[model samples]
Target: MSATTATARPTRNIESLTERAAALLGGTPDDETLRRYLNGLSGVDAVGLEARAADLGTRSIKTTSKVWALDKIVELIDLTTLEGADTPGKVRSLVAKALNPDASDQSCPRVAAVCVYGDMVPIAIEALGSAHGDPDDGGVSVAAVATAFPSGRASLAVKLADTADAVSNGADEIDMVIDRGAFLSGRYGVVFEQITQVKAACVRADGTSASLKVILETGELNTYDNIKRASWLAILAGGDFIKTSTGKVQPAATLPVTLLMLEVVRDWYRATGEKIGVKPAGGIRTSKDAIKHVVTVAETAGEEWLQPHLFRFGASSLLNDVLRQRQKISTGHYTGADYVTID
Candidate 1:
């Protein structure tokens, strides 16, 4: 797609974000404007934030509710395989697993999407076949990690090319990593411009835009305050979803971090009447942990955020554990590992 067309796309306009920022900042979204708005954010009470997250984790649900949570977890998972060794065959297998998480039970819900490297988008789409469609419509979507994923160290041209290629190859969603260096150094405008450009690159041939999930790499940001700032910056840049990490960091998705990100989304929705999705990727490995996140989402962002379009779990192993838990719920006993397909 031409740059003119990409920039002209109303859905990915940078002004949409700047206008919102302007309303909040009382001026255009320049470096000073961003700094003022971001720095003006309320300080996060680390102890209180951690305590609340822990308290939310301790909340429990009934058996019937557990069953529902398990299914919802399965449905919200972005079955991911972002490895150097990933091949077309591996992507196809992942797509198959996403289409049918449980082979024995036809009633088992399919995952929300299959996330792979940008180059593997076609492989996933081909494998998904008829089941490849919008995630909101119960069809599995293909999500590709773009913008030099895991480490946003590339030039702007390369990043935009990476994103454009993925969208042209039929990726329904693009997960992009922000330039943490710029963000950390207080060059918020650079990060904001990059996110807007990447969102523009997500425009497909049909005039529709692929959803953009901006990865904050919260682990690298170092403090709760910075994480909150990055979350707000990402939302202000028109990211459809604000993601926690790339699953390659030391401390991927923590409860406090995810909760903080959800709070950002919650506040943004309340102020603008627009809903933004949140995906807490990495390190979330079990049904129990996923349920805690579910509870956190409900309590922070409300029940409306539980759907695939509104929330997602960027996980691979987490799905297997959820499948086991789901089987136990249906059979009154836990099934062995061999029951679910290994990714």
Candidate 2:
């Protein structure tokens, strides 16, 4: 699609999310469709999907588009640091890096947000400073991974408190994991309500709700059919974005899985007149891989998803790689990883 077409796209047709849910549920508050709508869905054609994603991965992006993609990639990074070794000092460094990814080039854009464990939210918030303030001057939001993080095994109350603690600590966004066990065991209703409850718990210090990105952990789900169902379920349950994996799981964030996610988001926008964001975390490391994912978003979901608000990459090393590519593009030589600051 042309850049003009992507940028000039009009606002999506949307009413309140509640109304959208009601419509999806066919106006019945206790409708069985809420529980069984995703059941019996056709299984994914894995071979075909992988083949298609492979074909798209070969697209040659050059010069202007390459530069644009690199800049955009910088903005889409989540700049994550979720290790057990995380410290206040580590979080501060990550926040600084997120606010200014490249000190040498003033044109380089800041990252979208800094993702960390719930306890580190305060450190990141303090380092970011007035997150709701002016963006051009310097504004980077903090995203806390809540709901038992990589696994959603805790009790409902615990999960709710986990979400509440992060928001109270000044998180602007919440990335939550779904109950994969419930989803796999045919308890769709349980999974659906879990997401709604977590979303409700994202209310910020000022009472405004934080944006919620539902992590489906597509790696565990194992099929495009499951990914598709999970994506729709998250959207119907008030998720602002549908994320791929937690990056802790094996085989996290493959292109075929991400392609299905983009398709689901695009189709959902067509159905509900509201756009939901897509984030593919885990296993995406290089600038080429990053741009390939960008291509998938543009082609599958339309250029509207290309914006930072609608797209993100949950990664730790992705920022450095993009920066290195930026340096290469400018000076006509590759700078080793030693040159870029590690996040």
Candidate 3:
């Protein structure tokens, strides 16, 4: 726990403390009540509580980052449908689908990320470009799903090994699914630990660190407020990026989920001066939808967020439309969606 939190752990009960805080900040506050209120804010995992509280005091919010590569986005859309279940030919076919570099100039992605499951990291890392003489054109560096993906229910040792195995196979980033059962059960420490431990296991061959994006599967969280809280919790607990879903859940990513996360990113950065990333995976399948996300960041979070670091679409289906729109805008001719491929 952060010293701030350790010092602020409530010494008294809520009613008395909140009342006291009101009196101290005075609009007619009470005794120990004030202590409780301050304790509440200070008691959140020290990193999250006090730091976030400090951030809430800022004057204005900065926007998302602006500099990012579209090609990178096109490169990393994890086609999880083919993972583990596919043979080498099927995987190669999917890889072919992934590395296709047709989207160029105005018709390209905003830089795709490499999406492979634990078993496919080596293939994706080794075969992501045309430079290898593969028909595939470009893609982001590899990102492998870890932490017993699709569900974070597992022994910590197993989860850690999964993360290490992916990076050892060449994944540049680790996408870890958080333990929702723990989070929902109010076992915050376990949830925090699962992520931190997974992140710790994501080291490069040279001993550097791979970035971590924690998946909350927002649909199951059930409320914007809880989603926002979870975003804060993940970052405070050591997430490099806060993601919406695992795509395995129904009612996955949504505008509201993205909006709340953006707000938290805005808040977290302001508080800690650390820029956290955001990814909205699952069910976001249209270019217009992708652009709407862009619009939200451009407007709510600021244009600075246009880059791949601060923003990404965890999609297998959206790129086709983005390419179609880019093609339509660049060449002045609208094309059929199939020209780009859907899955």
Candidate 4:
């Protein structure tokens, strides 16, 4: 299937976040335009998408460029640990690593955030205290995977409760997984409504709300067509970021998948005049892979999306490799794994 284009075009016209939200939810705002745009979306050509992503992956970088990319990618990282064995101690350790990814080099930039399960949010918050300050004050954010993360096969009440628990515990961001089963069944309305409801659940008691990243789990979606649909679905549903996978699935966070997401965010920005982020979790483990992703963001999405606010890599191991590469650039030789903390 080939990708379809409809009324999705960018314009200089911009609207306030409130206006966009009202428009999306109805009443004072209307989503008729958004509905038309989504309805007009066309199929995606899987072969062409894979080919283009492969071609873009071949683009190369040198020493100086790699150095710059390493630092930039560091800031785009969402250093994550979502295992079943995760403990408060483990979350604290990961938080420490995120704050100082490379203790050996003070020049190394801190990661964008530390992602953990909902129960671990308080631990991460405490560990990161005063280290970078609150997220509004330049401190690293604490992200929690909620809404029955990695599966999303739960009731709405349960999901919202899970989200409320995380936000109440001081999570700066909430990475919620959509109900892919509903999405796959062509129940677009169900998927969209759930996202809006989850977005609402992100609000804390202080009138502040956590940033919401809607995970599409592109692996389960199967084709680029579904990925495209899901991408627009999440965005229209008020997702702050459209993520690729949960890392538990095979074929998680591939280059083609991420490249497509970058394109979606770019298109969404053009059509809505609002910027959203793209995060590819799971298999991204090397500095080379990380830089290629940044290159894709620059070429496909634009340089502005290269920042942490608009782009993030969801991996725990990727940070250590980035730090190790930075070490090699500094000392002229690859350092042992022992040189960096085990994240």
Candidate 5:
């Protein structure tokens, strides 16, 4: 696609990809169509991905795009470690990091929302201070991954309880994974039910609502069409953010997947006027990659998606790279590893 053509897509400039795909096949697309699309696709047959690419290219309004919503993005960036912090030292380290994210030599996002397993919320709460204590200087507002996470094998009641407990412990966001197996089985309704119920469980410690982000596990879903369909469902089901992967999956997040997601968000925005966020997590260990995602956001969703808001790279190891790059850009030399400290 020509750069000019790519950058020209507005609400009407682009075609409805899913609907187009359905029309291409001469049938309405349902969860089964999504499943079939994910099961196979080659460069020769990937018209959907091609269309999305073309549409993204033509998008203008760069700065006004939703990806630039850093205030929104920063709040949703969930600094997570699903392996669990098994010791007091680890919890203390997490606390210290939350309070002093700059210790990593990279200034943390303005509000480094902590994402711990349900077990660590109390420690995070005390360490950061009631996320509810003050609007400022408090610890991170916790986000807990629920719906059994990664494996996603659990009863509906159990998953709902997991979400409720996370919110009860002061978590501000619910990051839940869709049941990949069920989704793959062409059971989108089940996936929808899962996210809807869990989203309902999100509430603040003060008894308010916590935002919901639905993890698509894109690597496993394996196709742009499927990713788009899943993105639609999550947002329609109340996902505040549509994430790439769990950071547990191989090729966790990729430029291609992120690009597809940006298109999904843009289309979603045009349809509902409700802008949802996009997070590309897993396997992102460098600042350059983060910057590239930033650029993708800039180009795809426009400048509005540039900051942490509509765009975020989920990485335990990426902050340092951003810092290093910033420092390198700021100063003239490679100051070496000695310049930064990690707790």
Candidate 6:
């Protein structure tokens, strides 16, 4: 099947956060306006959401289709390593893996991107060398985690600087954690401004902006309602993607949560004629789990989202399992534990 491209909307034309917020809220971009708009959103039906996700998971794919799904999952993965102990060698190794996930089978598709820390962006770029460009063009992208990733417990100045540093260092994408404290405390305007500012900081010297993925860390949000609200807030504030977690928290990237996020992306596209991406990061560690997500994306958001630009899996170990599955399908036998690399 050919990949479908979604219509691109230029967020840079909006000029300022205030204007962006005003365009969404229909009034001044103040706390009151943000609260009113967000609060007016419909509440989530937890039972219905879970039931739909579960039903989608039970749908089986044919063996021939499974081949396509496995390769597509590989193409959609943001091969990630965000450890504090990550070194230049580790980044280089990861870039190599991203470029060639299965050395034995050159037919294996490359992953979407290699996610790393802000400080490691240059290392990832240097490692990628000629193979780093656009994921849509079969080249791996360098995605950096910034804005006080995971905890997000820092001042706005610090977060903006973090974003700027990453983009300046040649990160093709920025995964930023939102201030959950502010969002939960009803400081919706604060979260909105932060995302918009971070988006601004993503602008590079060449006049192009790095893709900004706003991490909601839904485990901390506590309810499906907040997840839906946060997803909308991220889109309204110019986030290119709404990510589920920073991979440090428990209960990250549940199917129900991902389905809800996809619903939001679908809704946004329906209302605005622009497409937004979704990334379900953390705890997705197997081919079965990855294929389930692929199904959910297809059913809820339409097959157009099957493209790398619209959907992604933020994972590390998930690739090995997928490579194993691919080998099993090709040779009619499962490979040993050493078939895939540990990294």
Cα-based RMSD of the predictions, in order? 4.8, 6.3, 12.2, 8.1, 10.3, 5.0
lDDT per residue for candidate 5 within 195-259, as digits (tens), equals: 76676676434335666778999989876667777787676556778999989988688777888
TM-score of 6: 0.93
Give the per-residue Cα lDDT of candidate 2 at 82: 94
Runs off by more than 4 Å, candidate 6: 1-20, 334-343
Residue 251 of model 1 has an lDDT of: 96
Clashes per model (N, Cα, C within 3 A): 0, 0, 38, 3, 20, 0
Query: C-alpha displacement of 318 in model 5, angstroms?
Result: 0.8
- The residue-by-residue lDDT of candidate 2 on 17-118, one tens digit each, is 557677767753232666556664566788988998999988876566778889988888889999999999999999888877889998998887888999
Instruction: Give per-model TM-scores.
Output: 0.93, 0.88, 0.71, 0.86, 0.73, 0.93
Model 5 C-alpha RMSD vs. true structure (Å) is 10.3
lDDT per residue (tens digit) for residues 1-343 in model 4: 0001100112111134436645654533224544555557876778988998888878766666777888888888899999999988888889888888887788887888889999887787778766533322345777889999889999999999999898887777889999989878777777877888888887656555677889999889888878997898788777888999899998899999998888888887788677988999999999878877888889999998886667889998998888877887689653433232211
Candidate 2 off by > 4 Å = 1-19, 27-32, 40-43, 130-138, 334-343
The list of candidate 5 runs beyond 4 A from truth reads 1-77, 104-111, 130-139, 204-207, 307-309, 334-343
Candidate 4, after superposition: displacement of residue 145 in Å? 0.5
Cα lDDT, all candidates: 0.86, 0.79, 0.60, 0.78, 0.61, 0.86
lDDT, candidate 4, equals: 0.78
Segments in model 1 whose C-alpha atoms lie over 4 Å from true places: 1-14, 334-343
**Greater-lDDT candidate between 2 and 6:** 6
The candidate, 1 or 4, that scores higher on lDDT is 1
Error of 5 at 203 (Å): 3.5
lDDT of 1 by residue, 1-343 (tens): 2222222213445556767767877886678889999999999999999999999998857766777888999999999999999989888889889988999888989998899998898888778877777666677888899999989999999999999998887788899999999999999989988998898898776677888999999999999999999999888888989999999997999999999999999999898898999999999998888999999999999999999888999998998898887777678552433232211
